[model samples]
Target: MNKVSMRFLMSMMLIVGGYAFAKAQSAQSLLKEVDSKVKSYKNIAIDFKYALSNEAQGVNQETKGNVVLKGDLYALNLLGTKQIFDGASIYTIVPEDEEVTISAVSDQDENAITPSKMLSFFNDGYIQKMDITQKVNGRTIQYVKLTPMDSNSEVKHTLLGIDTTTKHIYRLIIVQKNDTKITITVNSFKANQPMSANAFVFDESKYADYYINKI
Candidate 1:
């Protein structure tokens, strides 16, 4: 082929490649926008309903929980237990057992989803794609599907539904390889709520008679 024809072909290929790159990057861009909106608040409080189901195993459970997050500190109440993270350590209190467990955050635990990571976990280790949009209860929700990059991971895929108008998360559905599915739906979301500096601090005095385990 002549030099002029070769150059023209190469330019056309570059244009096509650039367009494909932009399309793939759109999902991540939307996620980043959601993260920014979430982080803008001084604090966030969320009431969510958690559901787990497995057809083969015949297991289905549903529960309600709440979490408050500020910076790296968080207070979570789930499954009849309260967990507090004060940036340095985690304190887990079980009311029925009247016990409290304290532990330092380890490297392995860093990847665990905390209240702060819930909105931003899709930023890494996943192939994200814009899925579908639906109107529920008069609000439009846009869903983004994420598949784990690691083959050995138990998670099959995750769907994150976001309120398009508010830029807030509406629901999250996680499917596992074992056919187990977990869904979390946000019932209420409040941001910039007044919170004390000691919101995440664990006061040992309150659980005087409870068994204490430190690790």
Candidate 2:
């Protein structure tokens, strides 16, 4: 090829590379801003819709849940169960079975994304890239795709949608290796609300009729 043609091709490559790098940097900065805003809140309460689907397996489920988080503590209600993490131990209450299981936080799965870590789990173990931006219900939602660094992880990738104006998370979509997809969409989000003194505490006396199993 001619020298002029070669130079032009190289220039084009450089331009494309530069744009890709800038896009990556922008995604990182946006995530950092989201993390900062989440940490600044004293506490957060969220109501969300949950969905799980696997087309190949013909499995589909949908539910609604709510969680209240403060520091490392969180109370979550989902799938007909209530789980409370009080920084030290986790108490899971199942009304249908009339059972309550108590276990130490250290005994829980290390990779499991608990309610307390839901918003900030992307801070580690992931490669972030800016994705598409869409208009949803008159709100601009910017998406960021995260690929897990762990090769053995069941998750294939995750798409996090952030509200551009509020800088708050709007939705999370997790696609697994087995083609199972889990999506969580935030319906309501509130921060720094007045919480009861025992919001994270487990009151065993109230559940006298239920069987308590401590692990």
Candidate 3:
């Protein structure tokens, strides 16, 4: 090959290699940024507008509620109804029926420690893979897929809608093994706020009457 032809071929190879390297680096940086932000917040409480659809069962439910999660304690205020997980016990309050069901955490294997379970995600065996970017309400989000390394986990895989500009998790889609999909949208989210210890407690006496269930 002549000198000009050799230089041209080398330049093309360099360009291709540079593009590939940049793409890989970008993905890594985004994942790292996500981890950093999640790690920084130890406790979080947010109000969510949730849409749940069970395709197999043909059931759809929509609910709006305020969720407070502080470390191990948690509570959900929904439609005059409340569900509280006070570390050792689980309490469900229904105002209409004027009843409360209290169950031990050890007995209830499937407890909701998710969005309301305010523990910091360790990001241990979870894998973060990049997906396609899509526009949500005019905000362009980079799709990042998350799969738990442990198969025993209740969650199948979570699709995260990450705001590219703010680099925050706008929404999360959680799919259970039974194919139940729950889309949780953050109506309003605030992080690192000084949550009073009282926030996580369930005021049982506030309700008119409550029932107890052991099992």
Give the whole-model CA lDDT for all candidates, comma-separated. Answer: 0.90, 0.95, 0.72
User: So what's the TM-score on candidate 2?
Assistant: 0.98
Candidate 1 to truth, TM: 0.88
Error of 3 at 12 (Å): 13
Summing lDDT over every window of 10 consecutive residues in candidate 3, give the lowest-scoring window.
113-122
lDDT of 1 by residue, 1-215 (tens): 99999999999999998876776687788898898998798899999999999999999999999999887789999999999988888899999999999988773254455676888888899998888899989999989999999898888999999998899999999999999999999999999998887899899999999999998
Give the winner by lDDT.
Answer: 2
User: Which structure is stronger by lDDT: 2 or 3?
Assistant: 2
Q: Score candidate 3 by lDDT.
A: 0.72
Candidate 3, residue 22: lDDT:
74
Tens digit per residue, CA lDDT, model 2, 60-96: 9999999999988999999999999988999999999
Error of 3 at 96 (Å): 3.3
> In model 2, which runs have C-alpha deviations exceeding 4 angstroms?
none
What's the TM for model 3? 0.69
Which pairs clash in the backbone of model 2?
none
- Candidate 1 residues lying further than 4 Å off, grouped into runs, are 1-23
Error of 3 at 178 (Å): 3.7
Model 1 scores a C-alpha lDDT of 0.90
TM-score per candidate: 0.88, 0.98, 0.69
